[model samples]
Target chain A: MKLLEEGIPLAELSIERIARTAGVGKAAIYRRWSGKEELFVDVVRSAEPADPELPGTSMRADLVVLLETQRQRGVFSRQSVILHNVHAQMKSSPKIWAAYQNTVIAPRRRLGLEVLRRGQSNGELRDDVDIELLYDLFVGPMLVRSVLRPDGDLPDGLAERIVDTLLEGLRPVSSRPG
Target chain B: MKLLEEGIPLAELSIERIARTAGVGKAAIYRRWSGKEELFVDVVRSAEPADPELPGTSMRADLVVLLETQRQRGVFSRQSVILHNVHAQMKSSPKIWAAYQNTVIAPRRRLGLEVLRRGQSNGELRDDVDIELLYDLFVGPMLVRSVLRPDGDLPDGLAERIVDTLLEGLRPVSSRPG
Candidate 1:
């Protein structure tokens, strides 16, 4: 992971390097994984966040927490390198791509869906909200920004602002009785 | 552009093939542009939509039109291939990257910002709306979706739905009277 974060090409990730980095024997690494790709997948899978504790509070708070977690994960050192590499290789390396989607993308999407579902069930979100589109709205900007401006910092309170805007859009008209 | 849409790698974009395909001599192409990179940039620049005429009927309509244009430009044959290529090469080919950003990305973003500014002036959106964030909200989903599901079709009325969600969230609360 450190090597990847430092922007090492995926092709350069050798078993010897991993063994040396982790202070393990090459034999130990070989016993558990077939190759660098498999080992890389395992490292990413291990980084998946455990099932998030739902805030069970307001939809705004729940969404804020959810997006904040995503932001933190993305902003972490070297994760962006891993993400960029996987995205670039999605077409050329189906196996690695599948592993990345299954281990990283799918789980995060599922967690987001769960939060949106909770919002809908609690009458905080409009019944018609498209769960998939809503999920994209929640995290798409951060993802795009990360790609376009790798070194740029997001404005403070961006997560809160995204939640506020989305919730404002999602709330039923009748519910906002002033 | 045709060759790129057909998924030719940038390295494979040859002046001889381009000349043959376009029914022109290789000398003719070289006489106009210094090299393939410059020619490719010009081709992309020519494809950019001229300043889009805003309907100004409503924010929702304006946003729908804006996003629809983005979708069309993205979905046009193999523009995605062009986009992916440019993105992948941004680090290695700063000149091409700058040209792409100037010709493709910056113009579209400028158009979006203009529309949002209009909305704010017309009292269709809150003065406090973060224009940059709003811009992302309008197009981020589509961008992310296009990348992730290159072949998956968006549901009908997706443009409308995205606009609806964003407008609902962005309209000033006080403006919506019971």
Candidate 2:
């Protein structure tokens, strides 16, 4: 993981490097994993976001917390670096891509969907709101901003602003008469 | 461009193939551009969205039209294929990366920002709205959805829904009164 964060291409990573970095012998690594890809896949699986404890707060507050946690977990972190490397190599490595998606990407998405579903059940969101689309709207800005300006810091209160905008949009129509 | 859309790797794209595909000799291609990357960059530059005639319409209408146009231009098109290929190769190919960003990404963003600024001046949007952040909020959901489910079709009325949500959020607090 350290070597990956240092931007070493996955194909160039070796058992010798891993063993040396961990102060272990090559035999030790070989005993556990057959090759570099397997070892790296295991490293990524370990970094998956655990199912978060939902705050059970208002939809807006829950979404703010979710986006904030995604930012902390994904942006400017070793996990993010690994995710990028895996994505870049996805076309060539199907097995690793599936593991990455199932472990890293899917879990986060499931958590977001669960939060939206809770909001719907509680009558905070409109009955017609598309939870899938709503989920993307809530997190898309931060994700794109991170990619476009990886070195730049996010503006203050971005999470709150995104949630506020989305909640206002999702309000039941009858509640806001002209 | 046809060859690229057919899934040929850029590095494997040949002048002979292009010439054969276009029913011209390799000499014809070389006369216009030096190499594949330069030729592709030129194709991308030609595809950049022109300065759209803003209808000077309401912010909701303007944004919906803008996003719909972007979807038409970007999703599942030859232009999008070229853009993705260039982005993937960006780190190793700085010149092509710069050309792609300058030609494609920047122009679209400028147009969107212009619309938001117009909204603010006309008092349709809150004066405190962050135009840059607002731009991302409007486009991010569509962009991320396209990436996450490239094979899945967008739901009906997606553009209208996104614009409606954003406008409601951007409406002045004093106007809502609730």
Q: Pick by TM-score: which candidate is best? A: 1
Give the per-residue lDDT of model 2 (tens digit) for B50-83: 4356576686678888877655544644336566
Of candidate 1 chain A, the 10-residue stretch with the lowest lDDT total is A169-178
lDDT of 1 at B90: 44
Task: List residue ranges in candidate 2 displaced over 4 A.
Answer: A2-8, A12-39, A45-53, A78-87, A90-92, A148-153, A169-178, B2-8, B12-38, B45-54, B78-92, B151-153, B169-177
- Displacement of residue A69 (Cα, Å) in model 2 is 2.0
Model 2 achieves a DockQ score of: 0.35
Across A36-149, the per-residue lDDT of candidate 1 in tens digits comes to: 777887776555444457676766677788777656655652355565564455445667766766766788778778877877776666656667877887787776665544
- Chain A TM-score, each candidate: 0.69, 0.69
Error of 2 at B19 (Å): 8.7
- Residue pairs in steric clash, candidate 1? A5-A78
Identify the candidate with maximal DockQ. Answer: 1
True contacts kept of each: 0.38, 0.41
Candidate 2 CAPRI category: acceptable
Candidate 2 has an interface RMSD (Å) of 5.7
Task: Give the TM-score of each candidate.
Answer: 0.77, 0.74
